[model samples]
Target: MTPPDLSVYRLVFRLGDALIRSGASSATTTKALLAVCTRAGLKHPSVSVTLGQLMVSDQPDDGSPPRTRFHEIEPGALDIRWRTRAEEITEHYLLGDVGLEEALEEIEDQVNQKPSHQWWKLVVGYGVLGTGFGLILGGQPLTAIGGALTSMVISFIFRILGHLGAPGIFGYAAGGFVAVLAATALNTAFSLDQVAVCIVAAIAARLAGIASYGAVQDAITGWYISATGRMMEVATSTAGLVAGVAAGIGAVRLLWGPSVQLIETVEADTTHWTASILGAMFVAAGFTLASGGWAVRLLALTGLGGATELVYLFLLEVGTTPFLSITVSTAITGAACVLISRPINLSSNAIMMVSLMPLFPGMLIYQGLLGSLFGLEDSGATLLEALITAFCLSVGGVLGQYLFSEGLWLARRRQFHHTHPGESFSKVMPEEYNSRDIMLPVFSKPFNGSEARPAGRTPKGRPTADA
Candidate 1:
């Protein structure tokens, strides 16, 4: 067999780096990289992915030496635009619509694509994001507005720190610290209730919801090394945020003494349904704009966020526990995104990551941290509850993906069997291939639930019985 040229390794490295930096999971990155290699005619290529780096290696079949390359992924915010373009190029390359050289150029173009929106627009989006979260967390109108201003300030701090090359954890810590100080000052001057609500909402973007979900999903998929790395990220990020908020609170207590009054905010009641829905949409839209995505894409995320919250609020009113309600809502949202993202030309991961922000435990984490700091007896329980909620969010997302992928596999198999009549299932899909393997190429195919080519179909459009 003729061996693939060295460009194959470069292709894998570039693609994997983009995906990882764009917040794709290690397993997903590895899968996409391998698919690229296979399509490029590289046999038995090995790809390894971690939180910060990727490694790819392959040997030539005609008695040539093996070549290995490694790439360090740069830290980047979640940008649906980048991921969407990458996926589109991959799909086109896989479908033979583009050659190797063209795909390589496309990858470089995406990596170098300038942000369409101005930096100030992103700051404005952050403000909107915080306001939405404040409303969702039951803050009053004034408090929600305070959250918006606080979040805008925090976004400024983050950008400045990034420009100065500070560590990411420190960025979170600084944002948290600023959030508390600003919220407290606003609350004191205006008598806005629910100070903590404002603070949490302002710093909601700092919460590790995506990392937590990725960690659990990686662990479930047996990528222990990547899972451990992601878990560590979640731990450090949350710890920094909690520590910053704690310090701000301590400083306030020391300065104001008895004059500083802090009160706990309760969850949103059913009467606040309008505010909650609006808040969710705000968060979704704000996230998209903040991430430098196209304004048109906000429609999908906003709709998804609003619908998910509507369902969640309804479930809560029906007497479901917060844990059960959030899990079910996240799962349903995940499945819905998977089903709809392809048709709309959006990234499912992007929608899932942003739409579920309202359900994240940012406020809970802050409340628990405050409780522990004040030496409240229920502090530990509150923190534990937050932990459980984060875990449930992860589980729900992973479960939703599996349910959708597997259900589609079954439906496709049944359709093929009905049409073929005499062919065995093993002819196309073997026992070794599971739903995950089929779904890993998500960037390459659409999940429209229609009659389409089987996942394992041959290049010539003929059904292949082999594994």
Candidate 2:
């Protein structure tokens, strides 16, 4: 009985930890680590991935004790840059371009890399994002300017709170509070008719659309635990936002009187297709710029955003319900993101995030929260409608992603099983593993270097094929 080499286990754990921190789902994490193990010559490695933890274990061919390692993942900011780099390292490792030690070093470097862009870009991006949504929500030029200013303030607050290690709820609540307070003051001072639109736009970036989409995608991939965790996140953030809006409204009401109106919902001006399309583009560009994305990807996503908004407007003009219209547009945008991600050199999540920004129901949620607070007769109905809309958006994105990506994943897993017989679903990392194929080798042989290489080593450099 010999001691098993722990380097392979460590590598799997490291990669999985990076992906999880980058918000990869449990299924994805499992599939990715398993693929790495399988390619590295491990016979049957086991992987378990949750939102905040990753575990990897593998049996040695020499019949030594099975080696296992676990890592606790601290989720970080949603940065497509880091996520893409991590995946590329995995791909390079699988291609035999780097040995186990080199792969580990690369992962470490990626983890410690500084952000590509400075902080002020994010503030500007948020301003543009708010202005775009303001126009989309039927606000005039003044409202757009007001919303942009408010968004810059919210963005600053968000960064400061994040740096200070404040709770997410506090950031969301603070943003909501500021948005409402600013809009109320502006409306009162200038008699603005679109104050509600401005407030909604200012807080649009804080919505839980990404989390909602992740929750549905995790559930679809059979990662129920991860799905539940994401759902809880969505609920908490949204509740915090609603509470903040309520507090803001209360403070404003106290300052003025009960008769002092704050938020005034206006009918969406769909006839301004030009403004709507441009608004969507601005939203997309703003998100990309703020996230430190590249210029080429920003332009591509901006185009995608405008195209999606066009589809939404066309659907509305043709008499589809607003909910249905957004759902369709979001699905189309998701599919487009998947298709174009490779060409644009952007992760699908990055493209999807920007492409679907125009469709988030921030306005609906704010309006519903305001109504509920004031005890409007239709408040319950508006809130229900908002919930349904969020659900529909999630479903649409999940379905779109599944159509292009996950369905093919199942096919490949089945193909691998048929070819190899009894490999246990080819050890796919779902919602997490950077997928290329289940059992396919990225190169003719594994990289040979230090003793840290994967198992099944013989005199030759080639790894023995899986049984």
Q: Which has the greatest lDDT?
A: 1
TM-score for each candidate, following the candidate numbering: 0.87, 0.83
TM-score of 2: 0.83
Instruction: Summarize candidate 1's per-residue lDDT along 1-467 as a digit string, tens digits.
Output: 23236666666777776666656766566656665765676645677776577877666564877667778876566767777777777767666678898888888877677854457877988888988888887778898899999999888988899889999889888987887788888988997656777888888777754566666766776767877877777677777888788788788778766466553634554568999999988988888788766656777788888898999998888999988998898899888867876666665666678888777877677778778877877778878888899878868866776688567656766875775565445312212222223233232221111112234554345333223
Estimate the lDDT of model 1.
0.71
Q: Model 2 — which ten-residue stretch has the worst lDDT?
A: 441-450
In model 1, the runs with Cα more than 4 Å from the true position are: 1-4, 62-65, 116-118, 262-266, 413-467
lDDT of 2 by residue, 241-305 (tens): 77888888789788866665566554456899999888888888888777767667778878888
The local distance difference test score of model 2 is: 0.69
In the order shown, the candidates' Cα RMSDs to the true structure are 5.2, 6.0
**Where is the poorest 10-residue window by lDDT in model 1?**
443-452
